[model samples]
Target: MENAILLLKHVGYLAVLRDMESFNFSKSLLSKRFEKMIVEEEKKKEGKNEKLLADLCECFVLLNQFCISKELLSIVLPCLLKVGLDKDESEETQKEVEMAFLALSNINEYAIIDKNMYFSEMKEIIQHHQEHNNLTRLAYHSAWEFVIKRFCLDGSLEDVISNELHFAKEAIKELEELMNCVDWKRTKEEREKESQEEKVLLRWLLTLEYFLGSCLLWNEKYSELIRCVVQVYQTAKGNNEEIGSRCIYSLSMAAKNRAMKNEDLLNGGAVNAILKENQLPTMDDVNTQISLKFLISITGRLKGKKKEKMKEEHRKGLKRKMFEKMEEEGYEDVITSFHGIFVLLEGCLYPFISLNVCDYFVNV
Candidate 1:
């Protein structure tokens, strides 16, 4: 029976992959196959068969990397997530769960650029994970990250930010429950636990940290993003250099995006608040230097097109403001380099001026 089930699961994995590439397969066709595969797998006795079933599910994860048939991708991708959450053995099951999520994120990345026909179900898939299973929660968190990235990065999806925000509010309500879990707080009584369990606890914390950071960066949720950074700092502080550094990294990303969009965050003052609240290194700290580099590039790219429209005085004022901020923060050399590059750019005024002067010279 176990062999039969394992064989069927492998066949199911192949079938789904084919369907993802097939022109004839509809979303419902893949959904039916998924249901059938899950039912058949459930009948097999636990242990070796369960592991085989997980391995089978992991095979379809490559579907995330493909751009073909998103409707089919949606149907096939969720099967991996289902397999991960269904397998109850946490210690042994981590690889499968992580693979499932990585695959699902690829699907989400593909979906972000495609049409919205699958969103109803895609939204439902993440919502279900957020509500019912901790193992699946991070995957769901990523779904919203896709929504935010699509909504903001592409500019084409800006119209849907409000709709996505509505979903974000709903997802946030669910994440609040995870914070209540005993494992989240790692209280004094729980500290005496074995090292392995501590590692597991730390993994979840880092997952939450990245998830929160990605959500904020993608969605422009600046205040909530700052709050998450502060929460991580208050709890982890000096004891966990890695998490604290990540929290700072997230802060820089969130702030950098806000600065680009010109979104007015409340004067709660996140940079100072985070700095004062926890003594984790400053933005100039070596660990966070990469994040600064990413922020500068991202901000420049975002503002590149729009900056041309601003008056000369306006552009100068903005540049001066940024340069002053950088110098005051002890990043003067980076700011000076940025300005040196800034001077080399062909000014936005050239094309019109060139056009008019050519016509004048031709007439003369």
Candidate 2:
């Protein structure tokens, strides 16, 4: 079984390397055999054949590295997640569980597509492990990787843009928990020793970053997310550019999209917190980008009382009109809408204009 897994793993890997989109694991005969093996292996394990259980568990982990068909996923995802996520005292049982999660994460893309079946289960698995911090570092990372990969640019953007904020809200909560888990007092050498832990923490940030990038809308309720992101930027900028850069980009998007009121961000004081630090680390490439986005959002949101009065009177009709246009304009159209407005202002702007972006930027 082990040798068969490796042979198939390499063969699938080459196919993925050749053309991932075209690659499909076409081994129905083998899959049938493995399915029976999995069922039989359970009885063998009950008979104390520990080797079979370990081999089967290891098989799932290794075979999933490249890709798996939906048929394979239907067979593997539930089984792996069910067994892998169980917290056990036995070292061997623990190892099997760990491998199960790691393997499941590799094929999480497929698992997520059939959201009705596995979405909630996978999310619950991640939440359980995150709250308890029970999984080994690699296994813990796999849990996060599984969810984060769902939002990859090539995949469906619906999860990010869905009116139901379940995924986004939970992600921000997870980000907060991961932030608390980080040991800021650890020395550089100590951090180096535990790079996997560091990576798990970064994964949380990346997950949120992916969310902010893909999401096209936000409401006042999500203001806390902006605060959490800024908190991450404040701590990580001096030492970790990757996290800081991602935070800044997230901030830019948060402000650029159809975001919440500026006052909500202002009240949180997270954007203001960025300015309190004199450190020049976080302003690498997106300083101007962040500043411009916030500027547009603020100026866009802050209109005259007359406009407000007009909005109040015409709210219903305006909503109908805007909603009618939204589908046509879409996110791409809205983002690029600023392009024309900027072109008109470019000539009036100074060659070098210095402004405290930390002020209105965070307010957005």
Candidate 3:
């Protein structure tokens, strides 16, 4: 039967088969057979049928890819999650888990679209397996795709903002829990030894970056979220450039939001956390531009009353520090680092002009 299925795949027969009147009927029959086998395996007392179940999952994935049918996905998703989330500590089982997640990541969107009810179940499975580093990375990407497709693309800005804010709150809570699990006091060697777990942590940091950017308009947790981003930045800045850059970008987005300002960030200690490191490595051009824009926004937005002169002085001090850093880092160095020099020049120069123009009138 396996050879026959292979032959059908090689010959491209499944494409034709998927369009036939009997396609649904055959899919139903296969679903029933797999369901019965899974039930029988569960009833066993002595031996586990891990190999059989794994192979069944592999076949289901292949069949689903060929057919692209929602019925097959609904039948297979639960089984895949079961194997993927198994807490077995064997190398063989780990391979099965990777396979299961790879399959799940590929087909997750179909299940999400066809059965909106399965969205919560899918999130639970992803969250449950986050302890497994490899699976966690895959699950994050899958969840990202699902969220972007459902909330962002082709949607009104207001609707997108609403959905993103809702998801961001939940994502922030999950990230806090994951961050607490890391051993921050490990020696350099000990930290280097757990490369897989480090990757998982980096993925989580990137996910938080996405959530923070999405929640810029959400003022309820504004201070807390800024602190969280600052913490992630301090942790990742020296270790991983991509993660560090993302952290900066998230911070930049927050600073750009009207709901936040220089005072709120400074009060939360985010401004100090960002500026305290004088010898930090140079971020990529993109992150450099984002960080620069954030500085410009905060500086341009400074407002004060005659009675609040101390607050105004504090904001001015922060802006001076940002400008000094930009000069020491070399504005020309940043502009020339870009592959598209003209575009980068425009991005840097045009924004500054507009910001200064607005700042002049506001000050007047």
Instruction: Give the clash count for each candidate.
Output: 0, 0, 0
Number of backbone clashes in candidate 2: 0
- Rank list by lDDT: 2, 3, 1
Model 1 misplaced stretches (Cα beyond 4 Å) = 1-57, 62-75, 78-102, 106-113, 126-136, 142-221, 258-268, 273-286, 291-364
Candidate 1 accuracy as lDDT:
0.43
What lDDT does the true structure give each of the candidates? 0.43, 0.53, 0.51
Q: Estimate TM-scores for all models.
A: 0.46, 0.54, 0.48
Ten residues in a row with the worst lDDT in model 1?
A: 355-364
Candidate 1's residue-wise lDDT over 158-258, tens digit each?
43433443543543343344433425345655644524333323333433433333333344453553554456545555444454565555555544452
Which regions of candidate 2 fall more than 4 Å away from where they truly are?
Answer: 1-67, 89-95, 108-112, 123-194, 213-221, 256-264, 270-282, 286-364
Per-residue alpha-carbon lDDT of model 3 for 1-364, expressed as tens digits?
A: 5674345333322332222223452367775675566556655787966666556655555344435455445546656666755667577676556556545533422233433534455555545454344344434444443443433222333233344334445445655655666566677667665444445555455444444444434455556667776776777665545556766767776676554655567666565655443224443345545655565555446533212224656867865765565455444344233334334323646344333322322222
Runs in model 3 deviating more than 4 A are 1-117, 123-194, 216-219, 256-266, 276-286, 296-364
Whichever of 1 and 2 has more TM-score, that candidate is 2
| Model 2 lDDT tens row, 248-322 | 666655554443444445555543543333224334324544444544554454432123334554544543443
lDDT for 134 (candidate 2): 66
In candidate 1, position 217 carries an lDDT of 30
